[model samples]
Target: MSDALDRRRLLGRALAFGALSVLPGCNYDNLQHPDFADRALRAMSRWNDRVQAALFDPHTLAPTFPASAITRPPRFNAFYDEAHVHVVDGASWQLELFGNIAEKRPWRLADLRAAPQESQITRLICVEGWRVIGQWGGVPLGWFLRRIGADTKARYVSFRCADGYYESIDMPSALHPQTLLALDFLGKPLTPPFGYPLRLRIPTKLGFKNPKSLVALGVTNVFPGGYWVAQGYNWFSGS
Candidate 1:
């Protein structure tokens, strides 16, 4: 096999082993120490991220499903419990833009609604092992980036959420045609549990990378590590 294929196969094995280590009855405690096994796992995760990044194609689109395949009442996930979910007021919510952008302003929901909208039915694969397909509608993220005069050369696009959730994506994924600033779900305004007003729908990434209830976005050369990333989840997290 070619070197690239070999690397890909190795990454698959690393990922599978990592997954198995967390299953029920596994000796997770023994593996948690700062020993060779732990270090090796971390190294493999980083290597897998690099491999996925090098193989990523900006023009590639994730598979889409029909309306019948859409999951009803998409699952809710957050760093905190459901009771502690951030409830944003639609009338007062504004999206803040900062870092490497010519125009830094707070955008109201009406501003997003006025832009051209796109819709897609895509699957959200969670690291926790469940998947959901949902129909989302929103403005194309790339178009919004251009409209706001974002620095195209910046390396990362980062988000800050009302629920203390933060995440970042590489610039290539940020510019993907399927990436969206999602505003509606199931053909209606999004509910609080579903990230009302605005959420990111990045089909290229794992579910957590698509943060909900976003308050601000930053474009920068510096890497803005995510909530789960700092807690040892993979930084790239491409699906």
Candidate 2:
């Protein structure tokens, strides 16, 4: 049998043999069932998430590079090709707010720009084993979170994007100083192929966590999974 099939069979047997009992709130029967194997995989993913979260340091910052190190012609990445990237109208776009926040009003581009901005030259590490360094500038997310009176104690902060992508981060990761609602890339406003208007630029996590073309944001205690995460990518995909 193929190695991939062998691994799957091993995982199924592990679940049946109680190796998946380490996962909290999940019960597995001692039977070799297809559904049991799938649940076992999910349980393992959740366990990995908890381990990464425990190892994460909220105060530790990701390494920053000088301007000279910035990658030229920054690599454009998405689930879709650049030719199919959705163009958004910056003038008509509004960042809607929801859940556990005192401010429910939508914020426009100008409002976001008015906030104090920070710039960073940081590396974007992809889970596919590629990395690129680029310059990004925007309002610090932690500052904005406080400005909106969001309950920082909430467990998760979720995002909705123009391209139908959705993602969520832990509260500690959300409050990381390097996390930004990035509006500028390479000292210029983002273009359509990039995350025009606004995007999340989280240096500490893998590239997929930095979502593009943000349309909505919310703070909640409930779990809000991501597009790739639902397909079995690690939710706490730390660098």
Candidate 3:
């Protein structure tokens, strides 16, 4: 419990620092400037991502937990607070597929449900240094990609969410067996606060990589930096 509290405190401080670093006066882009601090930080972030990518084993699965280990009311997280959570209307929801795909169409909730589906109890490790276990059910991301005839050779798979959130993942992680276009959590349809309709559940990546309330998914070779990534967070935030 004390460790969790400590992690929470560290996360709070990190978030505060990130917020300040991106303020109007802060110039993170001028790496050649005399202030070497920002340059060093950016270098470290890139190094971390490279090392993780080199060490990543696509076949190795993240550890799963028993039902008893599942966290009750999994902690809610987003760029905004709970009150600002995007409320998606199920009746009007349609998922757009574009980019390097052979088929370009809008998918409804029924379309996803009809695909091959499975469930897993996995941990969601946050960049904030905390983690929680939850049961998520949906179609395997790879299966869905193949079903859509997507360009599997693409370097990245990116997502756009209803709440103005966006994120991208490397092809290896996107094809991982544990990665899911999650439609349900804890055996029930996801609620508004928890990203209703669809969420990306990736046990191998940090919480931020798992975007919520997905409105569009694209396959591309170009890097589509996420909301946090644009604000100087690491792009490949693998767990």
Candidate 4:
């Protein structure tokens, strides 16, 4: 418990520094003032998000690598150890869609496999500073969103995972060309440890933004805070 508290405190301080660095003329000398500090951090975080979004170029693409650049025996990461990885039954798995979508129907694995497929060899950079290059193939999120008649202008696209992890991304990032509903990894269907059946494979953001074993997706204007974002990480963590 002490270790968790220490990590949270460290993260809080780092975010406070980020807030101070971006917003000039802000006073936060008294760390004892929790209320004031919390308010300042919230405001600064939102401001940082706006700045990042404004600077993001929809036309620009993340750098991609060749097949040879793929990481061998890809690294497995999650809140749980590999031994505890959730095993999703691919045959029984169905993607549920709701909120601002005209087609509320569930999508089966066959449906996704039959859709137009795109593949990319890209890097997945973790916030912890490790990165791995891998090849992923799946449906383009932009095309899928349009096909389902989702509100393209919606502020947020939220995802619920099989392992209880949840995340959200802005509409622009969701519609980015590199954003994919990844079905295959390393030229084959994903194994249980790597989010089998369906996972998001967005190269534009950090690894956590690319949720695995996606069960439900929703489009909404309401702010859908992610697992890590709720724990103080920046919401718009653009790579």
Candidate 5:
């Protein structure tokens, strides 16, 4: 609906600056391999596949929680640029999709929410060593794929966040009945602090796997990057 923010230039600058200012405990390194700099970008995407297979491999779930528990929200692990007027102001928000998707797209939040919807109470685990059970309601990603007429070749769906986060998931994870593009929270409109407008919920993985304040979807066969992976968190974070 809106134009994609050409943020590569500015975001690149910020990432460069971050390499120095990362807080004391942060790794500030890309898994530091001899070939690290040359192929560091694939960390998150590769991990995404590993976890996806573990979850919906025509097998058991990665892990599932009981409905008796209600999540009270885990420690916020997002990096939101409140000042990013493009998302905060809602004047410039676009969602992109590529890869085997026949209908290349750029959708607005309103458009994404208008699609089919579903809900569930699931446990969310964070890589920071905590978990929370929460009720999430949103549209199933399969609806989006069907609408786009995705071909078999399309294996990975990539989401880029407004805060400069990237996450990729395999085709099954993208189409999983539980994977939702959430528009509401706890029976109320999601606030900006909690990935307002819209976010993705991949119940099978840690909370960090879900990208918040999402702006674009690039469906591709290639593994895309993720925020934590570039920082040395296990790319295939599935335990």
Candidate 6:
């Protein structure tokens, strides 16, 4: 929590330094469709997100203890999906993929499991400055991207969620070796509230971008605003 707060403070300082003030009196929304102020804010937020990644470069990780060092019970911040049923019940769940090279397709859990898998028992460092060591078991996101033949025209990948939340990232983050669509934990199926069937785990980014109850994956060249971004929060939320 303190860490997230610190980042918030840093963001304020950055914005002040940049002299990117909200328009006075004149409503940005009323000025034009999509609005210049809104676009400027989004760009500033994306730039701010790079701060954390620059802070932590782990060609060699920091001196932290092993998994056994984690306290008995992990802290839960309750950022799980506030929408959608606890269980997907199979039949209705969908992971729709749309990209430039291929027609759209919907995939379910079974289809996900059938793809190539990658497991990494590494750190999950939340924006709140807390860290957890857990083994993520699931198919690599690259597997899906490859299946859909993500194209050169697509520079970003967006996660559309059933939770009324959305998140996005550039090709570099999406293709990071550790990125996964985690579906299991501690050798068992993920609990209902812990992004059950799958969630994007981009370890280098803050947990906020980890979209739960994922509904669709859209590949696009333009960067779209995320749920938090639309609500006056940084779209990148990285680190």
Best by lDDT: 2
Better of 1 and 4 by TM-score: 4
Backbone clash pairs for candidate 4 read none
Tens-digit lDDT track of model 2 for 1-239: 45434433423335355655454543333224435556767789899999999999998999999999988878999987899999999999999999999988999999999999999999999999999999999999999999999999999999999999999999999999999999999999988777999999999999999999999999999999998886568899987
lDDT of the candidates, in the order given: 0.85, 0.88, 0.85, 0.87, 0.65, 0.65
Angstrom error at residue 129, model 5: 1.7
lDDT of 4 at 182: 94
Looking at model 4, residue 214 earns an lDDT score of 94
lDDT of 3 by residue, 1-239 (tens): 65433332211223456665554444433423413445566688889888988888999999999999999868998867899988999889999998999988888999888888899999999898999999999989999898889999998999999989999999889999999999999999999888899999999999999999999999999988898776567888887
In model 2, the worst 10-residue window by lDDT is: 25-34
What digit string (tens of lDDT, one per residue) describes model 1 on residues 143-218?
9999999998899999999888899999889999999999998899888888887999999999999999999999
lDDT tens digits by residue: candidate 6, 51-110: 744554434322334557544454444444235445655467878886564757688888
Q: Who wins the TM-score comparison?
A: 4
Clashing pairs in 5: 47-235, 47-236, 71-133, 96-217, 98-219
Clashing pairs in 3: none
Each candidate's TM vs. the true structure?
0.83, 0.86, 0.85, 0.88, 0.70, 0.71
Please rank every candidate by TM-score, starting with the best. Answer: 4, 2, 3, 1, 6, 5
Task: Give the range where candidate 6 is weakest over 10 consecutive residues by summed lDDT.
Answer: 25-34
Q: Find the 10 residues in a row with the least total lDDT in model 3.
A: 5-14
TM-score: model 2 vs. ground truth: 0.86
Q: lDDT value for candidate 5?
A: 0.65
Task: List runs of model 3 lying over 4 Å from the truth.
Answer: 1-35
